[model samples]
Target: MEIRKSRMADLPEILKLYEEARAFMQETGNGTQWGTSYPPVEQVETDIREEKSYVCEEDGRLAGVFYFSEGPDPDYAEIYEGSWMGSGDYDVMHRVAAPGRVKGAGSFCIRWCAEHSRRDLRIDTHRNNLPMQHVLEKNGFTRCGIIYLANGEERLAFEFLPKDI
Candidate 1:
C-alpha cells in the first residue's frame, strides 16, 4: 500500500470508507466513540483544503484515510493520569478509518505517519476502541494518558517517539 495526500476526486470514496469504518466500529462494540457523523463532511473538506488529509492506496484504490499534521494540538495540551512520552514538536494522526477488508491497512497508515513525520507522534482513541488500541500498540505507540476534547469528552492518548523505532 502507498500513502499520499487526498485529492478532491477521492471524496466520494473516502466518505464511503468512513461509513464502512463506522459500521465496523459498531460491530466491534465501539459505537459510542464516533457516535454518528463523526469527522463530518465539512471537516474532511477542510482537511483536504488544508493539505492535512491523506489516503492509503492499494492497487490504485483508496484503502484507508486519515488526518495528519504537525501539532501543538490544543486538544493534546493537558494530559491526565499519565504524561506524554516525549516533549517538543510532534505530529498527530486523527480520523484514521479503513473499510476493514484490507489486512494491515490501518497499521500501515499509522506506521507511515510515524516514518514520514521524523518526529514524535501522538494519537488518541475512544477508551472503548480496543481494536484501535491494539493497532496502536502493534505500531509501537505507547499508552500515554487521557486527554479531553473541547467538549470535555475524554479519550485515551498514545504516543510514539522517534527513538522507539
Candidate 2:
C-alpha cells in the first residue's frame, strides 16, 4: 500500500469512501459523530486545491482518504477537560476513512503521516470511535485531552511526538 497526495480527479472515489464511512460508523453505533452531511464536497475540493487531501492506494486502487494539516487547528485552540502534551508546534490529521476493501488503510495512513511529519502529530475522533482510537494508539499516539470541534461537538484528542525531531 502507498499513501499519496490526492488530486481533484480522486474526488468521486473519496466521497464514496466518506459515505461508506458514515454508514459504517452508524452501524457501529457512532452515528452522531459525522452526522449526515459531514465533510461536504466543497471542503474536499478546497483540500485538494490547497494540497491537504490524501489517499491510500493498494495495488493501484484507492483504499482510503484523510486530511492532514499543521495544527493548532483553530478549533483546538482551547482544550477542555485536559491539556496538550506540550506548547510546541504540531500537525493535525482529520477526516480519516476507508471502505471495507482496505483492511489496514487507516493505520497505514496514520503511520505514514507520523513518519513523515516534522513535529508532533495530533488527531481527534468522537469518543465512541473505537476503531480510530485503536489506530491512533497502536501507532504511538497518546490520548492528550478532549477538544471541541468548531461545530461544538466533543472529540477525544491524541498526539504522537516524534522521538528525535
Candidate 3:
C-alpha cells in the first residue's frame, strides 16, 4: 500500500473506513474506545484542511486513514506514568482506521512516517487496542507511559525514534 495526503473528496470513503474499524472493535470485544461518535466528521475535515490527514491506498482504493502531525501537543504536556522520548518537536499520530483488505496498513504508515520524519514520533491508543499496540511495538515504538487527552481520557503512549539518530 502507498500513503498520501487525504483530500476533502475522500471524506465519504474515509468515514467508511472508520465505521469498519469500529465494527471490528465491537466484534473483538474492544468497542468502547471509539464509542458512538468518536471521530467527528468535522475533526477529520480539519485534519485534512491542516494537511495532517493521510490515506493508505492499495490498487487505487483507500485502505486506511490516519492523522499525523508534528508540533506541540498540549494534551501530552504531562505524563502520568512515563515520560516522552525526546525533548524537541515530536510527531503525533491519531485516529488510525483501516479495512481488512490491506493487512499491515498501520505498520506501513508507521514506516512511512518514520522514514519521512526527522525527529521523534509518537502515538497513543486505548488500553484494549491490542492490535494497534502490537503494530506500534512491532514497528519499534517503546511504551513510554500513559497520557490524558484534552477530553481527560487516558491513553497508552508510545514513541519511535530513528535508530540512526
Candidate 4:
C-alpha cells in the first residue's frame, strides 16, 4: 500500500473509513475510543483542507486515513496524572482509521510517520483498545502513560522513537 496526502475529495471515503472504525470498535468492545461523535466530520474536513491528513491506498483503493502533526498535541498537553517519555519535540498522530482491509494498516501509518518525521511519534488510544495497544507494542511504541483527550476522556498514551536519525 502507498500513503499519500489526503485531498478534499477523499473526505467521503475517509468518513466511511471512520464509520467502519467506529463499528469495529463497538464490535470489539472498544467503543469509548471513537464513539459516534469523535473526530467530527467538520474536523476531518478541516484536516483535509489544511493538508494535515493522509490516506493509504492499495491498488488504487483507499485503505486507511490518519492525521500527522508535529509538536505536542493540544489535547495531550496536560496529561492528568501521568507524564510522557520526555518534553522534546515530537510528532503526534490522531484520528487513525482503517477500511478493514489489511490487519497492519495502523502499524504502517505509525512507521511512516516515525520514518518521515524522523522524530519520536506519540499516539493515544482508549484504555480498552487492546488491539491498538498490541499493535503499538509490537511496533516498538512504549506505553508512556495515560492522558486526557480533547473531550476530557482519559486515554493510554504510547510513543515510538527511532533508534537512528
The candidate that achieves the highest lDDT relative to the unseen native structure? 1
TM-score of each: 0.98, 0.95, 0.95, 0.92
Models sorted by TM-score, best on top: 1, 2, 3, 4
Compared with the true structure, what per-residue lDDT tens digits does model 2 show for residues 19-104? 99999999888999888878899999999899999999999889999999887688778887788886799998989988576788
> Tens-digit lDDT track for model 4 on 18-99?
9988988999989777889778989998999888999998888888999998876887776655577756888888888874
* Quality of model 1 by C-alpha lDDT: 0.93
Off by over 4 Å in 1: none
Global lDDT for candidate 3? 0.86
* Candidate 3 per-residue C-alpha lDDT over 1-165 given as tens digits, one digit per residue, 9 for 90 to 100: 899999999999999999999988888777889986769999989999999999999999998899988867887888878798788888888898875858888788878888878789888889998888888898889999999988888899988887632
Report lDDT per candidate.
0.93, 0.87, 0.86, 0.83
Flag the better candidate by TM-score, 2 or 4.
2
In candidate 2, list every pair of residues with a backbone clash: none
Q: Output the TM-score of candidate 3.
A: 0.95
Q: Pull out the clashing pairs in model 1.
A: none
Error of 3 at 69 (Å): 0.8
**Which TM-score value belongs to model 4?**
0.92
Clash totals in order: 0, 0, 0, 0
